[model samples]
Each structure stands twice: as C-alpha cells, then as structure tokens.
Target: MKKVVKFGGSSLANAEQFKKVGNIIRSEEDRRYVIPSAPGRRFSSDTKVTDMLYDCYHQAESGKDFSGTLSNIRERYDEIIRGLDLDLNLDDEFRTIAENFKNKAGIDYAASRGEYLNGRVMAAYLGYEFVDAAEVVAFDENGNFDDRRTDKIMGAKLDSIERAVIPGFYGAKPDGSIKTFSRGGSDITGSLVAKAVHADLYENWTDVSGFLMADPRIINDPVTISTITYREMRELSYMGATVLHEDAVFPLRKEGIPINVRNTNKPEDPGTMVVESTCNKPKFTITGIGGKKGFASITIEKAMMNAEVGFGRKVLEVFEDSGMTFEHTPSGIDTFSVFVNQHEFEPHEQQIIAGLHRNVHPDMIELESDLALIAVVGRGMRRTRGTAGRIFSALAHAHVNVKMIDQGSSELNIIIGVENRDFETAIKAIYDIFVVSQL
Candidate 1:
C-alpha cells in the first residue's frame, strides 16, 4: 500500500501550502517517501524561487554583484520559516549557499537549491528524515542519468528509511558534480522513486484539479477527465495538455503503478487517475482535445508519384539533409505534403525548399504557413465505433476544413491538421458534439 507523493512548486510555495501538504502526508501511513519541487508562484504575477536562483546564478556568472539577488532568495525562505514557526536554524545552510553563489556555482547547482531548501523545511515541519537526492541518485561521467545505478541505490536507501523527504530535480554526477534534468524534473524523480519502491499509487499534487477536456481559454470549464490510459495521456500530452509531465510516466508505467493527479489546493476533489489500461467507458465521447499552432506545410506534386518507388523517401531525405524533422507526412497518389513547425525552419527555410526542388524535383511545391494540429484522445473512442467519423462530421458542421489526419497504430488517438485561425473553433465543435450535445 505504499505511495510515492510529489508536491509541485505551488503546493510548497508558502507556509499555508506546507501545512496542507504535511497534513496530507501524516494522514496516510503508507505515504513514507516524499518528493518536493522548489517554491512556486504565490500569485499570478509572482516569480518562482527557481527562477530567482537562475537569475542569481546569471548575475554571478556575468561578474555582477549578486548580493541583492542572493538576499532576496534568502528572504523568501526566511519568510517561509517565520510563517511556519519552525525551530530549525537555516542560517548555516543559507550561508553555505551564499558562499557557493559567491564562488559562482553552476546553474544546475543553483537551480537545485530550491528543491533542496524546500525539502529541508518540509522534513523539519513533518518530522521526517531528509534524504539528499545527490546521495542516492547518480549520473554517469558523460552526464547521462545512470538509471541502473540510481534505481539500485535509491531502492536501498528508501528500503532502510521508514519515512523521508527526498529533494527532486537534480542528482550527482559520478565525480560528485551536480547535474539537473530539464525543467519540471521533479516529476521525473517522483516517478523514479515510485517505481523503485514499488508503490501502489503515485500522487502528483499541482495547482489544477485535473486535466480538462479542452483548453479552458478556448472551451469554458471543459469536462474534467476522471480516468485516462497511459496511451491516451501520451497523445493528449503530445498535442498540448499540461496536466502531467509525460516523461515522468515511463518508470511508473513500466511497473504498472497508477498515478493520481491531484490538486493541492482542493485535496477533497478527485483529480484524475492515469492507469495502464481500463475497460471503463467514458461518460463523454471525447476524453480531451488539445492542439498546437505555428506549423507550415509543404505540398509537393509529381506526375505518377505513386508509381515511383522511392518518391516519399526522396522527399523526406531533403528534410533530413537540411537538419529538420517532419511532423506529419500525408500523401496522395500524385501529391504528398510534409508538415513541420515554422519555428524549426527559421534559419534554413530557403535551403530546405531549394533542396527539395533539386532532390525530389516535384512539378510544383507550395508552402503554406499558419497551421495547427489538434488531437482527440480517448481509450473509449477506440472501443466505440465512428469516433473518428463523428469528429470529422462535427468539424464539417462547423465549416472547419481538416487539412490532414493521422492516427496511431494503437487507435487511442486521432490527430487532425487545420488552419491556425480555426483551432479554437474546431475544439469547440468537437467538445459540443462529444460533451455538450449529450448534456
């Protein structure tokens, strides 16, 4: 019945949030191991503690006096300590960090202090043992995460400790140098620890209650997804859902551990359950809709293209040679199109187009910009027939012309391309047919 619980930056932003987290941890006996991120924004306009650390490091690296920046960061923790009324003295730790900053510690070391400091305070408040991630987590000399060593060491460390708070985000290199994962890496550490200990569930506490069926800005209070399979989650995440860190799911998914995406502010609310598989039918037709903009499509046409054996390969090689990856390639008998993000082609636009003309030599090449991709993801859709047909029909009713379509081999997700201007309208149309029409 063990559970690996992770609290995001917002959940640990201030003392009040800390109290709530302590209560949640204390209430569950099996919640022995905890992973915490740096203090997040207290309000919409506030900067995060991690961001401040990065700024401080930048000031130091640029040879600018960062005493003021360092003090501000110290003040943030001081305020939290004063509010929590903790007896632990953080002066020594603060001083040590200040010294490190003066010595110009790398950005990774500086960024990691956020989680390290927060974990210290949380452990003191909850009367739990504090385990430094650097001691248990390991990276090879090449700076790659040594998953095998990390899993073995972390498993042994947690095996002996009954209750502990482990800082997230950064681990130690083989020579003991500090290294960090990409942003929001606390999610990765939490999942790794969960798999190491073989927890029954991993709870990711964040600001949002759960994943919404569509972007709230586009669709008002879109239905919250109660349960989603890992395959479905991958699709939605790839398209643009920000509910959970998609990469964090791998470790837990391999071990068959379900993750509960919960809201720290609203602990009473059942957020979302991300599982390996389920036969449960969704209350709504579409589980979620997400999309991204800023795409460009290159339409190439050639006579008897279907008869040419290597037509597609010849067309894609131009992209590979020009150092670009194709997002989607939907083809017809005599015409084929390759879709890619516009931003990726910023510097090499003309070269790529010219190479395509020289290598593939199509009759004509048309470049269209301002495109968007939308995904309708749901496990239920795979079982219920005509899900794709219904989605297309809804878009047709809304007069939204879908430019391209691609579905994964799993059939858990269907992706459609449309003009950037119609992204919101297309999402609304799909939501109305799948969610509102029933209501």
Candidate 2:
C-alpha cells in the first residue's frame, strides 16, 4: 500500500503549516514517499517563496545589490526552522545560493532552491532520506521531460530507500542545468513519483478540500465531486476548474493509478478521488460546470457551401496560416462559425478575414465578440435523460441567452456558449438546477 504524497505550497507555507503536514504524513504508515513545494503565502497579502526567489534573481540579473532580497528569503526559511524547533543551520546553504546568484545561475536554479531547502527540512524532521529531484527527474536539453528515463532512474533510486523526501517542481537537464515545469508544476512532479513507485494511490494535498462542482466565486459552497474520471477531469480543467495541474493526470492515468486530492488543513476529509473509471454513480446529473470568457465567433455564410468537397478544410487553413487555432467549428448547410480566443484573434483579425475572402469566398462574414464557453461534464449524464433539456431550462429561467450549444458524440459533455456577462449567471443557474435544488 505504498502511497506518494505531494503537498502544495500552502501546506508547507510556514512552520505551523509544516507541523500539520508532518502530523499528516506520520499518521499514515504507507505514505512513505513525500514531495514538497516551496513555501506559499503565509497570508493573503504575503508573497510565495518561489515568487520571492524569482524577484531576488531578477534583481541579481540586473546587477543590483540583491543581498537584501536574498536575506528576506532566508528569513522566511529561518522562521520555519525556528517554528519547527529544528537544529538545522541554513547559513551554509544560503552562502552557496549567494555565490550561485552572483554567477548568474539562471532563474530556474533560483526558483528550485525553495523546494530543495524545504525538502531538506522535511527530510530532517521526518527522519527520511533527502533525494534531490534534480538527481532523479530527468529533462532533455530542450527542456522536455524525459518520462522513460525519469521513471527508470527514479524508480531504481526509490527502490533502494524505504522512506525519502523528493522535492517537487524543477528537474535537471543532461548538463545538470536546472529546468522547471510550468507554474504549478509540482503536481506533475508528484504524479511522476507515483508512477515510478507504482504506488496504490497518489495523494495531492492542497489548500482546498477538493474540486468543487462549480467555481466557488460563481456558486457559493458548491458540492465537492467525490469521484471523477480522468476524462471528465480533463474536460473541466480545459474549461477552468484548476484544483489539479492539467498535465498531472497523464502519468498516473496511464499507469492505472488513482489520485486522491486531499486537504492538508483537514486530512479527515477524503476530498476527491480521480480514477480511470468507477462504477459509483455521481450525485448529480452533471459532474461539474467550468467555463472561460473572451472568445469571438466568425460566421461565414456561402451558397451551396456544403456541396464543396474541401470547403471546411479550406476555411480552417486560413486560420492555421494566420497562426490561430479554432476552439469550436459548428456548421450548417450553408453557414459555419469558427470560435477562437478574442484576444489572440484581435491582432490577426483582418488577416484571417482577408484570407477567408481569398480562399473561401462567402456571401457574408459576421463577427461576434465577448463570448464565453461553458462545459457541463459528467459520465452520469450519459445514463440520464433530459440532461440538455435541463440545462436549457435552467438557463432560460435565469434569462440567459445561449448563443450556441454543442454536445460531443460521446455525450460526456455539453458545451454552451453565452455572452461574457452571462457567464457567472449561467453557471449559477445550471448549478442551482442540478446541484442546489437536488440538495
């Protein structure tokens, strides 16, 4: 029953938070492997250690006296060390960092120090061996993660150690240069470790208890999804539900390992279980409501357009030539609409419009902006009837107009487009019908 536990920055923000994490890990005997992120904000207005390190490195890059900035970062760790009442001395570590900073050791190196230092503290406190992520997690020269090499090396390394703390986020390239995952990448690191060890479960501890059915900002106290499939999670994450890193699902999902999204603040709560598939039924018709705004739709109408063999391909090529990607393309007998990010398309709008006129001559071209796309995703919806009817009814009752609606052939999700201003209202209406009213 080996489990890989990854704690978010908030779980390791300060000494108090660290103590809570320590207790959580000690409580579970099978939680042998640990991954820790840099200290996050102690409070709302406080800065994250990673952000502080980035700022300090930027100052050093500009050839400024960054000693003061570096000292502040040291104090953050010193405060944690004192709170934990550990006999660890970080002065030597700070000296090495200072020398590296003087040598302009890239921003990745500076940012990774947060996890490195925290891993040291975590290892000492838990009486576990400290395994630097750089030594095991491998990234190619081009900064692409080498999953095959990483799994082999990391697995062998952990096989030899009973208990160990592996810092999350940045890994080392072939030349040992530091390379970081994108922001919020510690989640990916944890998934990789889980795959390496073939752990029964991967536990991700964060500030929130788990993924909410709807955005908390839109729907107050929305229900938590007890279990969600990786496919369902991908749909929600693509739209905007961001409890877990979007890329984190790949590794564990491929290996058939389940991920438990738990809360470090409230370990008693089971949170959400993300698995490949589950027989358990969802509590609601729709598993989750997630959406994003700022999209524009381009409608092109042409006579006998459907009769043209390569009409759609020719139309899409214009967008591709302009370096633009279409989000959705819903077509009719003589009309088709292309949805895209408004901000990205704005700069290349005229070019795309001109290209469309040149390649696929149309009777008229219409453009609509400030649109939002919402995804109502759930496996339960497939087994239930009138799901789309319920969504339309809910939106209609709320006086929201749906500009477009598209359901995937799999019937796993229904995407609805609405005016940007109606985004929150639409999500609320949908939530009320499927979740709140049920309660």
Candidate 3:
C-alpha cells in the first residue's frame, strides 16, 4: 500500500523539526512520495521564510537596497544546515536567487524559492531524488492550472522514480513563468500527487491533531472529528472550518483516495480520516459546526410571489446583473430573502435595490446587515430525526435568536442564520447539544 506524505511549513521550520519529519518518514516504508512546504515560524514571534522572501522581493521591486533582507533569509537556511551538520552548501542556490530577485523575475519566482530550496534540503536529508514542481505541475498562459497536462506529465514522471520529494504551492506556466496557488496551496499539490500516483492514502501532517467538531476559539477543548466524508467536509469548510484546503479534496475525491490529517509533533495520534463514503457511524448526531460573519439579508415581499412564474429567476437576475453572488435565498409564498456578503453587497447595494425594484416590482424591500450563517453538517443527520428541532432547542436554551434556517434536499446539512453578536453563543449551544452532552 503506497502513501504520499505532505509536511506543512511548521513541520520543517528548523533542523530540529526537520529531524522529526525525517524520522516520521523513515518510520514507514510506504511513505515514499514526499512533498514539503517552505519553512514556517519556529516560534510565534519568528518570521516565516516565505514571508521574508516576499519582503525581499517587494524591496527589490521598489528599487530599494534589499541585500540585508536577502542576507537574513539566507541566514535562516544556514542555521538549519548548521544544525543538521550537513555537508550540503547552498551558496550557488542563494546566488542564483539573489540575481533573479535583482532582475525583477516576478513575485511568483521569489515566493516559489522557499519551497524550491526547502525541497533541495529535504531531498538531501532523506536520500531521495528531488523533483522540481515546475517541470511536473502544468499551468496555462492565463496562470490557471492545467490539470490534464499536469496529471499526465506527473504520472509519467513519478512512475519513473521509486522515491522522490516534490516542492508544493507553485508550478510553471507554459512559457516557464512561475505561478503560485493561493495561500495554503501545498494541500492542493499533495492531493494532485496522490491522484497521479494512485496512492491508497494521502497523509497531511500539520500542527493540529485533527479537525475539531467546532472552532476551538469559541468552544473550549472542542472534540476532534475522527472521520468525515467529502460532502460533510465541503460543508464545514465552506462554513469556515479549515484543516485542509477545500480544493484539495477534489482530486483525491475523484480517485476515491482517503486523506489522513495527522499531527507531526504528536505522531501517535490517529488524526482525522477523510473518505469518499463510509458505513461507520459518527460519534455524535452532528459531524462539525462552522460559521462566518459579515452577511446582509435582503427581504423582498410581493403578493403570491410563489405563484408568479419566473419570479425567482427575475429576482436573481438583479443580483447577477449587479455582479453580486447570493449565498442563500429562502422564500415563502409571499416573501423571499437573499443572503450575501455584506462588504460585497454594500458597494452595489443601491444598484441591486434599484434593479430589484424594476425587475421584480415587489411591494416592499427590506435590508438587514450584520448576520452570520452557521452550518450544522453531518452525514448521520440524514438518518436522525428532529435535527433541526434540536438545533432550535439548543439556540432557544442559550437565548440566541435564529434569524433564518435553510436545509438542503439531501439532508446532509442545516444552515442557521443569526446576528453576529450571537454567533459564538449559537455555536457553543449547538456543540453542547450534539457533542458536549454526549461526552
């Protein structure tokens, strides 16, 4: 059984952390394909290598003297090399990087160096061949990832090597210009590798032991989720839960390969397992609770709104014309409401309101701001009855008012809208009912 392991920035911050990662890899023979991110913070106050590179590049772009910044970044890697007591020297690599920065080779090139240099170090430490991501991961001229070309090339490339280390985050455009994925993109690289190699499992090692049932900032010592399905994960992630990049699930889910989120510091803990489907039952009535703030709701009331043909489409067209995306729209026979990002809506609010008046011609249009949407998602919810009632009961007991609630047809998740002030309280209430009480 082959497994692809991806280590996060924190896991390789310094030589000591690097040693830990090396041991983790050596412990398992199946963990052959390795992916590494740039060195992260060694301490809370310390700067990450990637951030330093970005600063250095910014200074260079501004035509300012940036040698000091470049020297500092080099020192960080030198310290790691010294600690490891390796014979490897990065003088040539650093010289090339400095030259590229001086030539204004683009921020993508500067940002990618973190991973590139780290990959070299990791390969040297592990005795594995180093594979440059730019040569394998394909991107189009528009800077969009070309997954078809990437998979074909990556698959052939990996099949030739028994063990290798690939840097994550950034790939190359067709013209060889560098392009990076959004922040936290290493997760995407790992997933893509797992798919290309057809690995049985993708192990993502980070600081956390696993995904928690609720955000820890709100609920003290929240329970960790042992197993979560792709659909449930998507719902929780969309609502703000973030152990892995949401996009990472796409490639692995397509191949039916599971991902295990493990803690690098505490290797013994069996972290969260994400899968395509499972017959195993969840520990609680809900899998996870996550929510975000800064939403505005627009309520449109018209007589016999449900009976009016194309009424919903007309109302939505106004938002589309305004270039605003609606998050959720729950309606009744006479009234319907559109929920959207408050900041995005504010700029186009008057235009959207005017369009709604012209297109739908509703009797009344009311706007409410400062709303938060909470998702109570679980696969077990489909089998359990009164899930919505339990959520309402919990909120009512906590004295938190619910502004709106929407449940999809699949019965996989329930969305609750509340005032921003009550977001934390509502989440705690739901956690107590579904998790704390059970424990």
Go through the candidates in order and give each one's C-alpha lDDT. 0.89, 0.95, 0.94
> Per-candidate TM vs. native?
0.97, 0.99, 0.99
For model 1, the superposed segments whose C-alpha errors exceed 4 Å read none
- Candidate 1 lDDT by residue in tens digits, 273-347: 999988778897678888999999999998998998888998889889888998888888889999998999767
- The sequence of per-residue lDDT tens digits that candidate 2 reaches over residues 328-369 is 998899999999999999999999999999999999999999
How does model 2 fare in lDDT? 0.95
Regions of model 3 farther than 4 Å from truth? none
Candidate scoring better on lDDT of 1 and 2: 2
Candidate 1 residue-wise lDDT at 163 = 88
Candidate 3 accuracy as TM-score: 0.99
Give the per-residue lDDT digits (tens) of candidate 3, residues 1-439.
Answer: 8999999999999999999999999999999999999999999999989999999999999999999999999888888888888888999998999898889999999999999999999999899999999999999999989999999999999998999999999899999989999888989999999999999999999999989999999999889999999999999999998889999999999999999999999999999999999998998989999999999999999998888899999999999998889999998889999999999999999999999999989999999999999999999999899999999999999999999999999999999999999999999999999988899
Candidate 2: residue 234 lDDT (0-100): 96
